[model samples]
Target: MNMVNTQVRLAARPVGLPGDGDWTVTEERLPALETGQVLVRTLYVSIDPAMRGWMRGTPSYLPPLGLGDVMRAWTIGMVEDSRNTLFAEGEIVTGMLGVQRYAVTDGRGVTKIDPAEGPVSAHLGVLGVPGLSAYIGMLDIGRPREGETVVVSAAAGAVGNVAGQLARIHGCRVIGVVGGQEKCRHVVEDLGFDAAVDRRTEDVAEALRRHAPQGVDVYFDNVGGEVLDAAVRSLARGGRVVLCGAVSQYNSENGVGGLPGYISLLINRARMEGFLVFDHADRYPEARARLREWVKEGSLKVVEDVVPGRVVDFPRLLLRQFDGGNTGKLLLRVED
Candidate 1:
């Protein structure tokens, strides 16, 4: 088949937030699929805070993208053509398809998704990495008990919102710490969070005191820096803190900001741990089954903030993740 592929390749390592000079968008002729390979036409690409870390040249959980390489991203698309017998033409699939209009893979990381299970978008958000992150990190790590107080930072986001709701389902009192009044209202009203602390309008520490007088039993932290420090001060005895992501310091030229001290852990016998979604990849099937049940039963709600654009517009689109410019999981729709 003859076709042109549009893609954004990393052109430079960004010091802070990624910009235009950081990537080169070009159109090239699509290569023919060989044995065991499949061609995917990207429908949606997930835009995440974790992508910022993947861009830095410094050592991280995953290797950084090399210059002129296709920008890394998780995409949900249709199998346009396939030499792999496992996948059929027109089958919906999800994988690390990168920032491109089309991707060719050997089916190494690809997973077939059933539209009958849910909407295709659900594969990118709820049943995808974000939902898995919330499930394993919160349940396995946080270990919230009935009537315990659970607080989630960046609570209106894709992972954080699901983490909060999962805590509530386990019979815990959930408090969501979001940036604005609208997010606060939506988190509490629309998503069934017990309470929401507006970081932009209210003092987070004071709000925690009012909502969780006894203390925070579990903290699902998405943002570090001051918000983390404030949450630390409210920990109850034997509390657990799940360190999911640190969007607050992703762009800092200096070191990422962190807890003022671990005294809360020492004093309250508390524990704080960092969670990477990939670490629990083996259990994804188990988690996905539960997520599917909840979503189908209408107990779990997934939110997606989709922006309209193509590969050439991805650099500017990434900036939205850094500035709290979008709510829930942000995605760039490469095709209608």
Candidate 2:
């Protein structure tokens, strides 16, 4: 018996927000695993803002998704079969498995997941890229000292939420810039942010000034554009800015817009630096160990917004990230 694989492929390069027309779903019979190959049954797929950037027809940190190519995504999956010596059958693993029900790989980038740490889905979230990104960006780049003011944009979202929480753990006064009143409340009341700025209703700069009168010492930027400008303007002397993700600009035709408040960096003797989580791959174990400990000890909250659906639902499910429809790490639970 052959396994049938369902996959979501890129149909067209999106202009702004992607629609149903931009994707093509197809099914294929899985080929037998060759030497060093593994077949994985995808369980959970990570929905991230970076997917928008991958759809663009341009050079980025990673090459753009090709027309008709399997949509790239981080996934947690169970190994159904394996010819690779390192990966055994029935093992759980996580890697860039694409938006598919089944994936065939050489197990190069794949890592076996220890379920004892947390749920397998968490291997794609708090224990995965978002968590590692937050850990590295906050400690290595942002470097928020105790009592300093740290602001995180998209603070209710995956990376931003973890970054904000990490800042709080380090004893920094954390403020979250989010959309809507409910999200604002979640950040402060639930996530332990010192304050919240509703980017939808309030003037971000003004709100930052009110919440962080001493100025923002560290800004963990996830949603760029206007929020970035506001954070820059409110920077304290010798401030550090960690350029994580720019979700706000991902869908724009013009790409990331210019930052008008960048001059504040010069005025305040501050620095702005961009980093890729892949660049710190060597330190992932260190980050994951600490993050897992936090999650286990209840110091770090693990919030996941999982949407149960088939592989065909990926296109619509991805829009939830941009529309502020998800409050935590958005995950597509690939149900049969």
Candidate 3:
């Protein structure tokens, strides 16, 4: 019997927020695996803010997913068959599995995941790039000290949630900037943030003043633009700004620009630095060990909002991340 694979591909470069017309879905027969490759049956698919950037034809840290190409995504899957010595049938793995029901990846590119350690979805989240981003940005770059205050935008998001909690672990007072009151409550009540500012209902800068009276010592920035401007204005002396993602500008037609406030950095003696998660690939194990330990100890929360159904739903599922429909790590459940 021949194996069948369903997939979603990029049909066109999106001009703005991608609509249904931007994608195409098809089913194809799986070909035999070649040497150094393994056939994977996808279980979970990650829908991230970065996907918006991938839909455009432009120069970036990584090349854009071309038109008619399988939509690129990090996925957790089980090995259906293997032609590589490193991978075996029935083993679970995670990597850039694309938006598909089945994928063949060279063993070199994939990472084996043990579900016994944590939820397999986590391999695409806290134990994955988003988690690693939070870890490296906080510990290596921001270097939150005990008794300092840390403020993060997109505080209920995947990276922001972890960043806030990790800052708190270092004995910093942590405040989160979220979109709504419910998300604000989640950040504070569920995630243990000292306070959460609802950007939709509250003045972010004023909220920062109330929550962080001493001014921010560390700013773990996620949404740039106005939020970044507000954060800069509220910074303490010698504050470190750990620049992660700029979801606010991902879908913009014009060039992305934030508040014109370079003078604030000079006045506050603040440092702003941007980083990609892959830069610390060599130290993933170090971060992974600590994150897993935190999860096991109930100190770190691993939240994944999973969208169940077929791979054809990928394009629609991806847009949800931008709309703030997801609370934590957004994932597409490709298989039962």
Most accurate candidate by lDDT: 2
**Against the correct fold, how does model 2 do in TM-score?**
0.98
| Per-candidate TM-score against the hidden true structure | 0.97, 0.98, 0.98
Listed per candidate, the RMSD to the true structure in angstroms reads: 1.2, 1.0, 1.1
**Tens-digit lDDT string for candidate 1 (1-336):** 789998999999988878778888878999889999999999999988899888887778878788889999999999999999999999999999899999999999899888887689888888889999999989999999999999999988889988998998889999999998899998999899999999988888888989999999999999998888889989999999899988899898899876785698999999999978898988898999998888888888888899888877788878988888788988888854
Per-residue lDDT tens digits for candidate 2, residues 59-173, read 7989888999999999999999889999999999999989999999999889999877568888877888998999999999988899999999999999989999999999999
lDDT of 3 by residue, 12-121 (tens): 98888998889999889988877888999999989899999988999698887889999999998999999899988999999897999999888767889887876788
Query: Which residue pairs show collisions in model 2?
Result: none
**Residue 63 lDDT in model 1?**
81
Candidate 3 clashing pairs? Answer: none
Tell me the whole-model lDDT of each prediction, alpha carbons only: 0.89, 0.92, 0.89
Give the residue spans of candidate 2 off by over 4 A.
none
